[model samples]
Target chain A: MMDSPPGVADLLGVLAYAELTAFLRFAEDATRHAPSLTDRAALGGLAAAEYAHFQLLRDRISSLGVDPEEAMTPFAGPLDEWHAQTAPGDWLETLMKAYVGTGIALDFYREAATRVDDETRDLVEEVLADEGRSQFAVERVSVAIKEDPRQSGRLALWARRLVGEALSQGQHVALARPELATLLVPAGDDITRMFARLTEAHGRRMAALGLPSRP
Target chain B: MMDSPPGVADLLGVLAYAELTAFLRFAEDATRHAPSLTDRAALGGLAAAEYAHFQLLRDRISSLGVDPEEAMTPFAGPLDEWHAQTAPGDWLETLMKAYVGTGIALDFYREAATRVDDETRDLVEEVLADEGRSQFAVERVSVAIKEDPRQSGRLALWARRLVGEALSQGQHVALARPELATLLVPAGDDITRMFARLTEAHGRRMAALGLPSRP
Candidate 1:
């Protein structure tokens, strides 16, 4: 057997938890926040896609003969911790999280899947497609914000906190799931460089989305 | 311009409500009721599929130049009233709702679709196929009920109540949405026959699922 890197399952487990939580959050936010019919329907459609992704992950986990919910539980705490610690304060904050957070994660998964076998790679592709829709929706919402710069400032601050908390939690996950970390660690000199690369990618995303990059 | 039955939209609207409520309830119930990992994954999978069907209804309504959510609001009360009155008391009751309640609804859609043009007929088939997994899941859960006679009785009683409330609410829908009633009446002596036919179909389904059929 090819010696696989550590933390692949942990990575996927965390991804699965993300999908489930995103579904609940997306629905709750729409039902509680968005003021228009068009926004609500678009959000509902996005929420539906999240649920479908959750199902796909569950199916993949089940096919492994391990109950998905069990494989899912171990990663819930750190994942939930990350989200709570970085909870988006307003509707704009929430929208940014949906865009920036899921976007980077999709990029990470795309990069990581190349190291995996074909079957899991296919699963990664399926999830990435779902993530792409969510990213598109958040971009649309951001454009809806372009007429007001004040709204953009609040979201920019929220994005800063999100990235900060995400970095902290990502480290926690690396510590907690050594194998997943090992899988991602390039045959490298320093973990710091890997973190820097990720941050570099994040800055580019903010520039593209018309949000300012934080120091 | 092609002429069409008024109830076609009504029928689809009811289905939209069913999918929405089913997803919401299953999300709550599976998260709350099921103690095991297997049951959670199983229930969540069905819940995800419900949202997909919900989207199809949404798309179809949009194609008709109606916002699906707005179209859905009018039918929400009657539809939700039925589900509340017919609340599944246990796990098996939940399964029966998906199997018997939805099963009969799908059958009616199929039978009625045959009278319409091919596009409408294809829509019915698409929605029914979206339901295929839930039906299979209900059967899987039924196996466990068969092993426990105690579970079987509770589920049977629940199934009876579901059918009764469904009939009551089905009538409410027809009375409330007369144009909808006319579309499915098929120039028959009375729309009462549609109700009768639906009830008979539910009865056979309950029997097939090993649940008691009568009030």
Candidate 2:
């Protein structure tokens, strides 16, 4: 049996842990930060979706003869720290964080997905697919911005901080796990170019919510 | 369109809130108290399952011409209070709470399911059905007790407290919502008999985990 690439396992491990923490944080935020029972249910549904993705990545890691937990442990600290630093203070900030943070991470993973084996690429793409739930964040945030235009500046800054913390933590993870970094920035590709693409997509997302992309 | 019984919406509302809170608490406990990544993922999956049930109950309430949020709001306090009073202290306590607490709630819902309309009964049965995730708790708690038999007393006391708190909050809910109470205790049926059944099932669950059912 031909073994999968080592970097593939590392990539899957990082993604699995991301999904797991996303599940936990989203659920936590929904309970503590949601403005209403309706919004709470919506965010809880999003959390469940993240958990589903976590399960898929976990099974794939195990299939590769890797212990899922062992594969996930190395990335936990950076991910947990990112969450600690970007913890939202209210429902709007929670929505903004979910939108900005998930958008960037999914963009990074989608880029990395292109470098993996066909099966792994397909799995990554499936997990990263936007299920339209992010639309909830967009609609809610847009309405909030429309009602109070002054809030836009603060939310925009919040989005920028989210991306900043994510990138800072991303750098830490990349430095610590060169193999996973290689998965994202392939042999001939520029790391800055990959980040540029992520930033561009993030700009469009921020605009969609009627917020400035940069501080 | 034939409207469902007044009590049916109340019943569904209470259940929707319960499942929503279950999702929140399970996810919170898993993140804060899980001993290992594997256990965390297992509890996260259980939380997702509870969220799925919450969606079902929420949708049912909406279809009945009720606002899901309003329907869920009334039961929030009692359920939240129940959780506040029984917050687990450690990983073992967390597991015990999941196993014992969920067991009694499911038992109570199962009894109340019989008192609803046929369609509602089916939905209730489906939501309350054990998906075997509780076995994770049973196995983990049983092994922990075997490894250190002295821990059994503490865990048993914890389980008893979980039931006591659940019953107390449950009484608060029932008294506050007589329509919901009547759904659980029909005019001819004895409320004590229903409690007896729930207690019996709780004992069986406790025994299966190799812990004494009573303090």
- Among these predicted structures, which one has the highest TM-score? 2
lDDT for every model?
0.69, 0.85
Model 1 chain A: lowest-lDDT 10 consecutive positions: A1-10
Per-residue CA lDDT of model 1 for A162-203, tens digit only, reads: 777777877877787777777777666455566777777878
Instruction: Give one digit per residue, the lDDT tens place, for model 2 in A98-206.
Output: 8887788778777877788888888887876755767788788888988899999999999999988888888788889887777778688877777778889989988
Across B1-215, the per-residue lDDT of candidate 2 in tens digits comes to 05576678878888889889999999999999998899999988888888888888888888888898888888889899989999888999998888887787688778877777877888888876765767788888988998999999988889888888887787788778887777788788866677777878888988887777897
Off by over 4 Å in 2: B1-3
For candidate 2 chain B, which ten residues in a row score worst on lDDT? B1-10
Count residue pairs with overlapping backbones in model 2: 0
Off by over 4 Å in 1: A1-3, A20-41, A51-71, A80-94, A117-126, A129-131, A147-150, A157-165, A189-215, B36-38, B65-70, B82-93
On a 0 to 100 scale, what is the lDDT of residue B200 in model 1?
80
Native A-B interface contacts kept, per candidate:
0.19, 0.86
What residue pairs are clashing in model 2? none
- Report how far residue A57 has shifted in candidate 2, in Å: 0.5
Please provide, for model 1 over B137-202, each residue's C-alpha lDDT reduced to its tens digit, 9 standing for 90 to 100: 567666877787677776767777777787788788878988777777777548778778887887
Q: State the local distance difference test value for candidate 2.
A: 0.85
